[model samples]
Target chain A: MERVVTINLNGNAWQLDEAAYDALRAYLGAAEAGLKDNPDRAEILSDLEQAIADKCSVVLGPRKSVVSAGEMQAILKEMGPVTDSEGFAEGAAPKPPVDVEKRLYRLRQGAWFAGVCSGIGAFFKIDPTIVRVIFVIAALITQGAALLVYLVMMFVVPSAETSEEWAAAHGLPFNAQEIIDTAKKRFGEVAENQNRMWKSAQKPPREPKVNAFVSPVQKPAAGYGARMFAGVVASVCALAEAVIGLGVIFVVWSLFTTGAVLGVEAPDAWPLWGVIIGVVVASAFVTWPLRAARRAAFGALGYDAAGSEAAFSFFAFIFTVGGVWYAFQYWPAARDVIEPIWLWFRAIIAPGGF
Target chain B: MNPDEKFAPLRKGLLEFAILKVISGPAVYAADILARLQGTDFATQEGTLYPLLSRLRRDELVDYEWQESQAGPPRKYYRLTEMGRAHLDDLQAYWRGLNQTLDNLGTFGGA
Candidate 1:
C-alpha cells in the first residue's frame, strides 16, 4: 500500500502519494529559486497555481484518483520550466548568435530622458548620438510627427528592466555584464570627446574622472532596486488574491457544515446515523473543492493538481462511511454526545429558516 | 516585420484606441476581448494584448470585476471606466485632427 499524505495548497486540501509529493516540493523549490529576483514573481507564481489547478482538474476524471509521477512531469512541461538551466548565471558570456533575435531597449544610464533614440540606435547598430541627431532633425522637418511617434512608442513598447529581461527581449541568454558593457560602449565616443575638450585646457592630468559619470560598478543597485520594488507590489497583489480565495472557501465550508448540523430531526433521542449522515454530507462538500484546489495548486506550480484529489476524496469518504457504520452499530455512546448538540441546534434554528 | 513574421501593429493605434472603443460598450472577459479583436489586424496577438490590457488598467483607463464561471475559476471581466471613455474621446479627436493634417500636407507650408 502506497503512503498518501494530505497537503493544503492554496487553502485547499489534497492527497498525494509520498513520491509525487516529494517531486512536487522539489519543483516548487526550484520555481522559487528561479523566480526569486523576478519583479512579477508573485503574479507569475499565482498564475502558475491557477494554471496547474485547471490542468489537474481536467486530467482527473471519474476513475483517476492519484496523480502519477508521469502526470506531474507533464503538467510542469506544459506550464513551462521554473528552474534556471545550468550555465545560465549573472554576467555569463554572450552566446554566439546562430539566428538573430532583435529586441529594442532604452539605455538606463546614458539616456537623455526616455532612451528611445538610444534603443533605436542599439537595434540598428549605429551611434546613439547619431540617432539622437536624426530624431532632432526629424522633429524639425516632419512637423512634430517624430515627437508624436516617439510618445506612441513610449506607451506601446515595454522597457527592459534587467539583464535577463534585456536578453529575453532579444531572445538571447542573459549575460548581464555584457549588456552593461554594450550600453557603456555606446557612450565611449561621447565620453572620449568630452575627455579631449577637458585635456585641451592643458591642466594637470587628473584621475580619469570618467568614473564619476559612467561607472560600470554602479549598475547593480539601480537594476536590483527596481526589481525589488516590482516584486513587493506583486507580493501585495498576490496576498489580496489569496485572501479572497480563502474567504470564499471558508464561506463554502461553513455553509455545508452548518446545513448538515440542521439535518438532525429529533433532538431528544438523536440517532447516531443522523450525526454520521451530517458528517458524510459535510465531508463531500469539503472534499471536492479541496481536491480541485490541490490539483490547481500543483498544476499551476508545474505539477498538474489532479489524480491524488480522487485518492484522498475516496479515503475521506470511506472513513466517513465506516465511521457512521460503526456509530450506528454501537449507537449508545454516540447518542450521549450527539443528543445535546442536536437539542442546541434545533432550538437555535427557527421553524422555517433552513 | 521579418519576411516570416506576419504580426502587424494590426490596425496600430497599437489597439489601445480600439480596445477602449470596444470596452466602452459591454463589459467583457479576456476571452471576449480576444474574440472582439479576432479577424482584425490585431488577431493572434495573445502576447501583446495582455500587456496592452495591463497598461490600460494600470493607467486607470479600465477596470475589471471577478465574475464566477460555471466551468472553471472566476474570471476578471474588464470594462472601461469614466476616465477611459474620456481618454478614448480625446484620442478619437486627435486621430481626426491628424487625418485632416495629413490631407492638407499637399500645401507646401511647414508648421
Candidate 2:
C-alpha cells in the first residue's frame, strides 16, 4: 500500500502521496532560495504556488488514491512551462520602488568608550563585539588617540532618526534610497523640462554663415583700432611735455643772460614754468621704478608680459632727457660773473663751500 | 458522493480560488483568514499563506489592501480584479476542453 500525506497550500488542503509531496517540497525550497534576494520574490512565489495547487487539484480529482510517479510528472508537464510561469500578474501597475533608510547608532547597552563601534555595527548589520575588538586594537596602536576621536564623534554625530529634521541635521535622508532615486529622476526631468521650455521660449535657429565671417574680422579690427588710438594719445602727451620743457628753458636762459650782462640782479624768484619742469623731471624718474614694481607684481599674479614695462620705461626716458636738456641749456646763463667776491663771502661764513 | 469525495473538489477549488480571489479584493489579513479557515482542512500556517498571497498580488490578477485591524497590526486583504475574473474564465474553459478530450479518449475503444 502506498502511503499518502495531506498538506494545505494557498488556504486549501491537499492529500498528496509521498512522492508528490517530496517533489513539491523540493521544488518550493529551490524556488524560495532562487528568489531570496529578489525584491518581489514573496509576491511571485505566492502566485506560482496558487497556480500549481489549482492545477494539481484539477488533475488529481477529488478522490483518495495513490498518485503514481507518471501521473505526477504528467500533471507537472500540463501545468505548462513552470519556467515561464507568470511570477507577477500581467498589467500589475508598476509601483515606484520604495527605499528603506537605515541608521547607525551608538548602543548604550554594549559600549566600552563612546559606543561608536557598537553604533556602527548596529547600523551596518554586523556584530558589535567584533567592532569593539577592532576598536580596542586600533586604540592600542594609536596610543589612546582613538579615544579622543571617538569622543569627538560622539559629540559631533547626531543620532539617526526617521524624522526629517534629524535627517537634515545629520545630512542624511529620511528615506535615503527614495530620496536619491527621486533626486536623480527629478534631475532628469528638469533637464528634459528645460529643453522643452527652451524650445518654446527660443526663436528658431538662423543660418549665421553669411554674417559670421564679417563678425570675426570686425571684432579683431575694432580691438586693433582701439590700441592704436591709445598709443597715439600717449605719444601726444609726451610730445606736449617735451615742448613745454623746451619753452621754459628758452625763457629762463634769455632772462638770466640779459639780466647778468646789464648788471641787473637776475630775478631771485624762479618762474613757475621752471618749477613745472622740475616736477615733470622728478615724475619721470619715479615712474620707471614704480612701473617695474607693478609689472613684477602682475607677473607674480600670472599675467604674461605684453611690453607694459617697455612702454612705461620708454615714456619715462623721454621725459627725463627732455627735462635735463632744457635745464643744461639755461645753466651757463644762470652762472654769476662775480664768483671771486661771492667765494670770499661764502668762505668766511662756511669753509666747505669756499 | 462520500463526504470526503463530495467536499474534496469544492474544498480544493475554493481554497485555490480564495487565495487568488482574496488578492483581488483587499488585503486579506493572514491571521483572520487563518482563523476562519481553521476548523476546515483548509487552515494553513501564516508562513505558507503569506507567501502565496504575495505571489497572487505580484501577478496583478489580484491586488491587496492593507487595512488596519482593530485587534492587531494592519492586515492585508486580498481581492479579485477584472483581470483575475477573466483569467478564471479562461481556466474554466480550458478545464472543460480537457475533460471532453479525456472522456473521448476513455470511450475510444468501446465505441
Angstrom error of the Cα, residue A125, model 2: value is 2.0
lDDT of 2 by residue, A1-354 (tens): 334656656555666664455444434444454445556664655555555665565566556344544455455443322221132223122123233454444443345544567677766667878877877788789766565466445433433221222222223322234443443444443335432211222222222211110111111112223333433444444345445544444444445445432354444585645644554576567454544554443233222354333433444454555444444455654234234334656998998873
Instruction: Give DockQ: model 1.
Output: 0.02
TM-score of chain B of each: 0.76, 0.56
lDDT of 1 by residue, A213-306 (tens): 2222112223333433432332333333333343344344434455333243334455545645555566556545544554443222221223
Candidate whose TM-score is highest: 1
Candidate with top DockQ is: 2
Cα lDDT tens digits, model 1, B1-111, are 673244332244336777887788878876677678788765523323444565577689999998999987787788988899899999999989888898888877833
- Provide TM-scores for the models: 0.30, 0.24
Report residue A113 deviation for candidate 2 (angstroms): 4.7
| Runs of candidate 1 exceeding 4 Å displacement | A1-41, A44-354, B1-13, B44-48, B99-111
lDDT of 2 at A138: 85
Candidate with best lDDT: 1
After aligning candidate 2 to the native by TM-score, how far in Å is the CA of A320 from where it should be? 66
**Candidate 2, residue A15: CA error in Å?**
42
Model 2 stretches astray by more than 4 angstroms? A1-90, A93-113, A161-354, B1-91, B98-111
